[model samples]
Target chain A: MTVDSRSEKTRPDRAAATRDRILDAAERLFAERGVLAVSNRQIGEAAGQGNNSVVGYHFGGRSELVLAILRRHAVAVEQLRTDLLTRVHPGSALHDWVGCLVRPLPAHLAELGDQSWHARFLAQASNEPTLRAVIRADAKASPSLRRAQEGMFRLLPAVPAEVRAERGEMSRLVVVHMCAEYERALQNGVAPPSRTWETAAARLVDAVVGLWLAPVTPAVLGPDAALRCRR
Target chain B: MTVDSRSEKTRPDRAAATRDRILDAAERLFAERGVLAVSNRQIGEAAGQGNNSVVGYHFGGRSELVLAILRRHAVAVEQLRTDLLTRVHPGSALHDWVGCLVRPLPAHLAELGDQSWHARFLAQASNEPTLRAVIRADAKASPSLRRAQEGMFRLLPAVPAEVRAERGEMSRLVVVHMCAEYERALQNGVAPPSRTWETAAARLVDAVVGLWLAPVTPAVLGPDAALRCRR
Candidate 1:
């Protein structure tokens, strides 16, 4: 190969390796420390970069860096969800659909083993005001996630749209926080409630299915009642 | 009174006021930023203290500062729960007991008005590895919370202990996060899913009742199944 072509081929390879290293360091630091607590300078130091500006150069800003971390795992998680969806059908039970919603993330974490920081990292990101919308929008963009939500909604036609939306948010919280807690437990050498990710996912599916299938209680008090009661 | 005695009494009043200021500043900063992200120096400056060591003098450490913030709200929350429990008899429905569990925090937040930071503060603390245990231990120490849990357990005679424990954690996550999200929405001028904290608590009660009452699905896979499946 010509000198120019050889250098061009190796340059992209080196850049990709550096990107991966930075991502790994950022994820672990963000997970261990709070997301907003850890600075880009710290991330660069952790990634073994001599230049403090390396994080900004690669990712532009914190929000972009968080999104890149999320998108890195999104592909594998989306594929897992899509794979699970293939087994689901129009007549499948609500439990099966809930499985599609809950399993993919934990399954991905399980593959990462004890050293994985994705769950905790996402948990931190979800609580940050600036980053929360980013995470939600990313989830909204997922075709497999959309399919899973649709599958669940189809199974519960009688549920009100608002209640469904509310329960959907609850399910997301439970899965993310529970997995984060489980990840912390494992890393701390403390016993987690469930023995493995599959079992933890199973427990989550049960509770989430219950959350979705639970009867909606109509608001007994008018909107003004709460205000009146407060006064 | 003697001049020395009068000065002694006034000094305590001044110290008490300083402590409250420090707590208020720390809570708001921690809520807006992540818990670990905000430092003692920032908290002192926000509280209008000229000396950075004031936080160290009053609260000692980050964990203690977090606990002090939690304790500040715990009294009002406990009182609210106690009053709610007075109306709840042993024969009261599970929903009533769930109300005791869910309503107190939201009710307390309602009393604090739009500017309250307790929910968001707790949400931030709960996600932090070091502070999470402090919050959990504080919750475990509450008499009213213990009563509410026992009341629910009485109604749920058939559920396994582990399942109950898992559901309790789920309940805590839902309450903390949903209220945090609602508070953020209200502050941002975005419409929340519920109109008021009272109404929000009502929605939470409905979902948590379902969570606690939901049937547990026993594990179909062995402990080794997850490990084996990975291969």
Candidate 2:
């Protein structure tokens, strides 16, 4: 009787552990050092793997490695959103949906405790237009995210298509960079006004909701069209 | 006569022309490639200088080069803000103050036209936590900016101090990134709904004003103070 002789070195659990180690190392390196500066070999060494090509073998290229890192956090963040979404009723106010959108990220980071690199990783990646696509793709998987976005748009006033698009960009930019700043402040022992994650999220939610619902000037909307837009 | 060798090379016109050329090349390269990724040699070559050390000799290092580029635009944008300030009254509405904050940026970009790299350059530098200090320093030199920020803060609602600081970060992030995205969209020939810079500025001003004035959630504002904080 021939037993399956696959090596223990290639065991499923071992491979999974290896992937996680590489991801953890890569994230730290990418966060502290700029993403473009740190390399696959450095990541392998950081992960304690003697093989230089382990990173490439597991994650392919820098972009895919980046995507993998994003996927790791995104899963947890999405789960948070899913859990948050269950608490949000269908007829909940815009803030409820906005909360679902905003809270999960900070909550997840807070749970990660100190020395968390996910926020900085996100900040660095999102700043680069090309790299931001990976994040967007990962985010698209979350049903809760899609629903929250839909909820916001459904409640949105008749903004010019351009204005809506631009504000959407602004909202995302705020979320991405603000968290990075908060994380930096925490690491540097600089106490910001919103001391806790809860308060920070609250501040963000208020500003973002206001940003979405802010009145467009009559001149830009055109007085007649602006009146039509109001209702 | 041994009278002033290299005098032609040291001419003010030659130096000014060289500085402008280097700035142009650095801005384009930094915008297309990241500020960190591009080397001084590459910038010097791009500027048509034969000596590799020309960039370093002319502008010190990457940080100084970046600062010089920022100073170039800050002067123009500050002038624009100062000019706009002359029209703003002591009791101008929040949107008016926000306008002073928003308009100078897009208006300057619009004038720089298709090949403008200033917005993207700002976005890239501002995203890097350390690099942002240079921008803050340049911004401090603008009396109009200080006045506009103070005006907005004075008009602000009963926000928690921490919330105020967090939102301030959000506003700067949004401004830096939104302009980069807008510039990209324009470059890619993506005709957004807001066709003109004028309309885009109007939209940005409205949203930013709303963001500043958005109500803080009572829960986060704490129970004892929620009532007092409420409008």
C-alpha DockQ for predicted model 1: 0.53
lDDT of candidate 1 at residue A231, scale 0 to 100: 26
Alpha-carbon runs more than 4 Å astray in model 2: A1-10, A218-231, B2-10, B218-231
Worst 10 residues of 1 chain B by lDDT: B222-231
For each of the candidates, what fraction of the native contacts does it recover?
0.50, 0.57
Quote the chain B TM-score of every prediction: 0.92, 0.88
Candidate 2 positional error at A37, Å: 3.3
Q: What is the C-alpha lDDT of each candidate?
A: 0.86, 0.78
Measured with C-alpha atoms, the lDDT of residue A143 in candidate 2 is 88
User: Which stretches in model 1 have alpha-carbon errors above 4 Å?
Assistant: A1-5, A192-194, A227-231, B1-6, B192-194, B227-231
